[model samples]
Target: MSDAPEDLDAWVVTLADTLGLGADEHPIGLLLDLTRDAAHGVTRPAGPLTTYLVGLAVAQGMTVEDAAARTRATIAEWKTEPSEPA
Candidate 1:
């Protein structure tokens, strides 16, 4: 259940089509960047969770760019905390 396809691009296209969304319409680059940052700054699991929450925000009217910026900002700040950070 946790495995990734050898070809991520193909998998994205397949999933998007299955969900009736255009794969090209999504800001895949931005999302990937956010995922990478969250995984590194927070935790491995946070990467997908962060994207899932972002997806919710998008579904609820927030633009993907704004959501990503907000999440990235959170990751940056969270990494800079004086206390033990994730």
Candidate 2:
């Protein structure tokens, strides 16, 4: 996380480089867009978990773009139950 929230983009770049993910090659925008979709479609806490799963999908031979596309489709069809009786 950034010390100054305004520098989040810079922080992400630095963090990616430090982690050896390479800022130039990292799909930051795509991942962030998918995370945003998950957070809104499921719950705020679902964002990170969804992204983590996406990474796992990448490890299992799926391309990030394909995983993200599939995830977004699933999100579009998701029907979440309320936290409590409505």
Candidate 3:
């Protein structure tokens, strides 16, 4: 119920069970890292969006680990590229 770090594991498990998702299919640490990377390297909004896309990719048969890896790679590439003016 609380957004505390200590509550994350239980929250993830409960949410996963509620959505009929398997924990094995969604690694929390990897997803969190990807979110952080996307948010910092790309855009703040990209954090949740990237995570959502990763979930969609997994739902479409991609492994979570692979999705995370691909997402991280893309974020890395984005970081290397110059940003366009707002």
lDDT of 3: 0.86
Residues 17-56, model 3: lDDT tens digits: 9988766444778888888999999989999999999989
lDDT of each residue in 1-86, candidate 1, tens digit only = 43454476677788999998876666767888889999999888999899999999998999998999899888988888734635
Give per-residue CA lDDT, model 2, range 25-45, as digits (tens). 667789889899999998899
Candidate 1 ranges beyond 4 A from true positions: 1-7, 82-86
How many collisions per candidate? 0, 0, 0
Give TM per candidate.
Answer: 0.77, 0.70, 0.80
Which has the greatest lDDT?
Answer: 3
Choose 2 or 3, whichever is better by TM-score. 3
| Residue ranges of candidate 3 with Cα displaced over 4 Å | 1-4, 22-25, 82-86
For residue 82, model 2's alpha carbon misses the true position, in angstroms, by 9.7
User: Which candidate ranks first by TM-score, i.e. highest?
Assistant: 3
Query: lDDT for every model?
Result: 0.84, 0.84, 0.86
